[model samples]
Target: MSVRVQADPNQPQAQDQSFSAAFELQGNPDQGELRLYTPLGSTAAGIQWTPINAVLQAHGETRQFRDLAQLITLVLGTDVPVTALFAWLAGQNQEVDGWQVDLSARNQGKIAARRMAPALPAELQVVLDN
Candidate 1:
């Protein structure tokens, strides 16, 4: 799975830049592995976790974190509800704090989500390549 993120222009700290990344995710929030690939299709980063520990691999190095969220933040520079993402992609709405995912147009291969609570509300629009 992959998503392209855009920050709301109306927000103060919002940036005009957009984020695009590819993901290879499995399992649920509690136990899963997610790998983010570079635009060139190289392995940019990866996160794997279980109840005991979470690890992040990037730049030919591995770092440990207490949870997936922490590792994700460190990697993406922001927090995304990846768990809810699967549900959203399937056209089901899952509650994600500060974020509202809209899949109404999923049939058209488009899905968008907005972060409402953050000071700089951001929008994430995903278009499945498949």
Candidate 2:
């Protein structure tokens, strides 16, 4: 699925890195691949991860990560609750440890969530293509 993520810099955990990216992620959060592209549709990076090994390819170079969290945090500048994403995408309001999700518009192919407890509160919005 295609997604656009916006990280608020005001969030303490955001570490002053305000990022916005449009990317396509495929596979399951447990074991899957993600391809991040430039707005113009060129590949910026690609990541494939499994329980044992995770690899990220970018800038014509490939690097291996010890785990998915590290790989994703390195790329996105923050750790996203990927496991909860499956539930969110399915229109289920599953709460992560520090995040609150709103799925009222699931039938409309839209959902939004936010981090509430953590010092850094960031919002996530998703719109699935019909």
Candidate 3:
């Protein structure tokens, strides 16, 4: 876990900024937690955290994950690259897989379940990758 402190604008149209701290987490496929603290509100999702050899249970079963980034990409469908995903998850610098994964129907278009990649693993990864 890590504390992310930064200036956050209260509203989209507001012209003010405040210091915010987000308790971020990184884990493998099955479990992870992302709890963010801001002056505005709490942004917590994907809280089941794991790592290399991290085991996650979903759909009535337990599974193993490669690393923390892949877990989020699988859960969120970001399709992050192998090299990049590694750098982010392993903490080569200071960022983890960061992206807004909007998997709405129209945006997804004709993308089918078979098309999404290591981006989606087994029944979990490709469900959105396609």
Q: lDDT of each structure?
A: 0.75, 0.75, 0.36
Lowest lDDT 10-mer window, candidate 2?
Answer: 1-10
**Per-residue lDDT of model 3, residues 1-130, tens digit only:** 2111222234455332222243444443344454444446554332354444444454545555667556544544334443433333333332223432222342443111221232222111111122
Model 2: how far is 104 from its true place, Å?
A: 1.8
On residues 3-113, what C-alpha lDDT tens digit does candidate 1 reach at each position? 334566667796654556876767777888878888899998888999778998899999999888787666655677877877887788888878888888899878888
* lDDT value for model 3: 0.36
Model 3 error, position 15 (Å):
35
**Which runs of model 2 end up more than 4 angstroms from their true locations?**
1-16
Candidate 2's displacement at residue 112, Å, is: 1.6
The full ranking of all candidates by lDDT, starting with the best, is 1, 2, 3
Residue 52's lDDT within candidate 2 is: 89
| Residue 46 lDDT (model 3) | 27
Candidate 3 regions exceeding 4 Å error are 1-51, 79-130
All candidates: TM-score:
0.76, 0.78, 0.27
Q: Residue 34 lDDT in model 2? A: 78
Q: How do the residues 1-130 of candidate 2 rate in per-residue lDDT, one tens digit apiece?
A: 3323444666656434455556677787779987777878898888998988899999989999998889877776567788888789877777789888888888998878776656355667776766
